[model samples]
Target chain A: MPEIMVFAATGRTTEQKRGLARDLTDAMVKNFGVPAESVTVQIIESPRDSKAKGGILFCDR
Target chain B: MPEIMVFAATGRTTEQKRGLARDLTDAMVKNFGVPAESVTVQIIESPRDSKAKGGILFCDR
Candidate 1:
């Protein structure tokens, strides 16, 4: 089984994540021969201030 | 080829993302029998306010 983890800032809806998971899993199965059911995709949503670059947070960027 | 997309909140360092990519790729190879070079992992950092749920953003979580 192939496991995939995706982290997104907390603003997208659950439906979006599900869509992404579905599309990504489908792509992996079709292209890489990985079984559709064997692919695991997870989305981790974080806060804007939880991430920063050059002293600026993602919200600032 | 298996294309994997990882979205981070932008707080993680490049090294961290690289490490994650390396580990994820290695796991895929060792357990899922995927070619190391053929597994593509990408990290996308989004703004906290770019996503929302229940009328609130991820940063507020």
Candidate 2:
């Protein structure tokens, strides 16, 4: 099974997330020739405070 | 460099996430003997409705 995990800021609509999941699965299936069901996608949402970039926290931006 | 991503339901404190990141990085450093700074940890949160298992959505359960 091919597992893909994405991390983004919180607050996306369900439709958007599902669309992304399907799209991601499609990519893997078409490229790697894996079955759709064999692909697993997990979109993880992180708060601004939890993520930092270049020594600065996202929440501070 | 190694990247470890985790997906879970939302509502964890920043402290918890940071602790997890540190711990995960530590594990990679000890096991793989990679530099601590080379490990990337991203904690992603998903809504229950966004995840499905065996054709049954998490929100429906």
Predicted structure with the largest lDDT when compared to the true one: 2
RMSD of each: 14.8, 6.5
lDDT of each: 0.61, 0.75
Model 1, runs deviating above 4 Å: A53-55, B1-61
Instruction: Summarize candidate 1's per-residue lDDT along B1-61 as a digit string, tens digits.
Output: 3445754344555665666566656644554444787677876677776645467876896
Deviation of model 2 at B8, angstroms:
6.5
Measured against the true structure, the TM-scores of the candidates, in listed sequence, are 0.49, 0.55
DockQ of 1: 0.07
Worst 10 residues of 2 chain B by lDDT: B52-61
What is the C-alpha lDDT profile of model 1 across A1-61, one tens digit per residue? 3456754456756665566666666655554455688677876667887755468887899
What pairs collide in candidate 1?
A7-B7, A11-B51, A11-B52, A12-B51, A12-B52, A51-B11
Can you give the DockQ of every candidate in the order shown?
0.07, 0.19
Report the Cα lDDT for residue B8, model 1. 35
Q: lDDT per residue, candidate 2, A1-61, as tens digits?
A: 6777677776788777767776887888889998877776776667789778897888897
TM-score of 1: 0.49
Q: What TM-score applies to chain A of candidate 2?
A: 0.88
